[model samples]
Every structure is written in structure tokens, then in C-alpha cells.
Target: MIQLGTRWLVGDEPPSRLPQPVIDAIYEVEGELAEQGVDASEWSWTLTWLEGKPVVELDDETTVEYDPETDSAIVTAPEG
Candidate 1:
């Protein structure tokens, strides 16, 4: 399992796949770090667990929760 900052990602073949948005986020962060001449791989990292399965959700609102253990992001819709 690869770790970056406080976020954790699960790497597994079959069924479990990394989300594109998460990957984009990582890349974005990586790019920013690179611009500063800082290598994220060399920085101190927090402990994070990989997920065993993929969990996805679609919501009309912009709220979500990240689960480290499951490596999942739960999103909730805004109440009208």
C-alpha cells in the first residue's frame, strides 16, 4: 500500500480499483510539491491502510467523508 500525507490508498488487483479523482488529487499534490523542489516520497508520511474493495457514491451535494481503513470516500447530498 502506498501512502501520501494523511491519505491512504489501497492497491489490489481485480475488483478493487483506485478512483480517478483520488489519483488526480495525488498527482495535483505531487505536482505542487515538485514545483517547490520537494519530493513527497522523501517526506515523513502517516500510517494508512489499503482498501480491500471499491466503494463509490454519487451525490448532488459536495460533501464527503474519507475512510482510511476501507480506503473509501462516502459522500452525502445537501439537504434542501
Candidate 2:
């Protein structure tokens, strides 16, 4: 079984497998972080599967939620 709370460093790979959409979501976050003057490899990602959907949360609390309806990844910025 996949662990409910898997943590991986920003530059490291998750030991547990992740869905393609989740990976795409991370990439989206990468670009956003870059624009914010943050290195993509300076933080970490935590994987959480909710209702069969993967939700990857970044160290700064940014999220990449998978939307099955659109078959796409949605990146949410961390709330101040």
C-alpha cells in the first residue's frame, strides 16, 4: 500500500510512485517558484491522496491538486 504521508526533498524523487498529473503539478509549481525568485530544489513535496486523487503540497504550503474533470493539474499558491 502507498503511504498516506510520503515526504521527499525538493530535489529528490519520491520512493513511492506518483501519478503523472501530480508530477505535472510539481513542474507547474517549479516554474512559479522560479518566478518568485526561489530555487525549485530548495524545498520539499509531501504527497497526500484524497478521495483517490493525488494532492502534492510543497514546503511553502503551495498545492498541486489534480482535477479529473479537466484531466489537468491545478497549482494553488500558499495563503498568506
Candidate 3:
């Protein structure tokens, strides 16, 4: 059983405070992924702001290896 959540980076500190609209969008996407038979534990989420717009990447079959010290994460999709 895999259960995970998304993490975001704002300007200085990581974006912990997601806007209401963004939160709703994320939840909607999460539900769609779950319905597609995505395992919760296999989730690796990345939320970033580019050009002052938010972008979200999610995958249940993909694994994101992250290092907290370096603030780096690698996203890889396993072969099905």
C-alpha cells in the first residue's frame, strides 16, 4: 500500500500554502489517477512555479527519489 503527497517549491521556502484553486485541481487529478489503478504509495509529486504559473506532475507508477539535504528529487517511471 503506497500513500504519498505532493511537495512544492515557491520562492524562498517550499510552497506549503497552496491556493484554494490549486488544491481543488490537485485533488481532482489525484482522484483520476487513483481511478486509473495508480497505487498511492507509488506517488511522486512535484509542484513548481514557472513564469508565475503553477505546474504539477503526478504519477502513481513512478518513483521520485529525493534528497532533503540537497533539495533534489529524481522522477522515474518504472517499466510496466
Candidate 4:
């Protein structure tokens, strides 16, 4: 079970309990960073649980909020 404010450690895989779409979205962001010549190897994924939903944040300030109703992650680009 996921506890509130659970954080995914750096260099580790994301929590399996999260939805598949969320997982894919996370990977996509990581890939994007890599393509942009950013070395995100040491960055971690931060998970903030709101009620039963998950709001994932990256070191680069990108956010991925899960929407169960749509079965997709509402990805917000990193704030500049």
C-alpha cells in the first residue's frame, strides 16, 4: 500500500501500484529529458497522494497528475 507523500527513490522504478498510463507518462517525460541532452540519471520521482489519487512531480518541476476517470495522467510541463 502507498502511504501519503510517498516518494520514488532515484534510479529506481516508479511504484507499481500506480496506473499504467501514469507509468507510461513518467517514462515519456524521462525520455524527453534525455532527448534534450539533460542528464536525468540522478533525478527522482516525487509522489504526492491526494485522497486516493496520485500527483507525481519530477526534479525538473514537471508534474503528472493521475485522473482515474479518464485513465490517464494529466501531465503539466515544467514551470519556467
lDDT of each: 0.39, 0.76, 0.48, 0.84
TM-scores, in order shown? 0.35, 0.73, 0.46, 0.86
lDDT of 2 by residue, 1-80 (tens): 55476878775765446667778667666776678888667678888888877888888888888788888888888789
Task: Write one digit per residue (lDDT tens) for candidate 1, span 1-80.
Answer: 54332433222121124554444433454455568775445343122334533332212222333556665555444478
lDDT ranking, best first: 4, 2, 3, 1
Clashing pairs in 4: none
Residue 19 miss distance in model 2 (angstroms): 2.8
Which run of 10 residues does model 4 get worst, by summed lDDT? 2-11
Query: In model 4, how large is the Cα lDDT of residue 11?
Result: 53
Worst 10 residues of 1 by lDDT: 7-16
Instruction: Give one digit per residue, the lDDT tens place, for model 4 in 4-80.
Output: 67677445788988999999998888878878988877788999888879889988788999998989888899656
Evaluate model 3: give its TM-score: 0.46
RMSD of each: 11.4, 2.6, 12.1, 2.1
Q: Judge candidate 4 against the unseen true structure and give its global Cα lDDT, from 0 to 1.
A: 0.84
**Which candidate should be chosen as best, given TM-score against the real structure?**
4
What does the lDDT read for residue 73 in candidate 1? 54
Best by lDDT: 4
Tell me the spans in candidate 3 whose CA falls farther than 4 Å from its real position. Answer: 1-16, 60-80
Look at candidate 4 and tell me the lDDT of residue 38: 83
**On a 0 to 100 scale, what is the lDDT of residue 8 in model 2?**
81
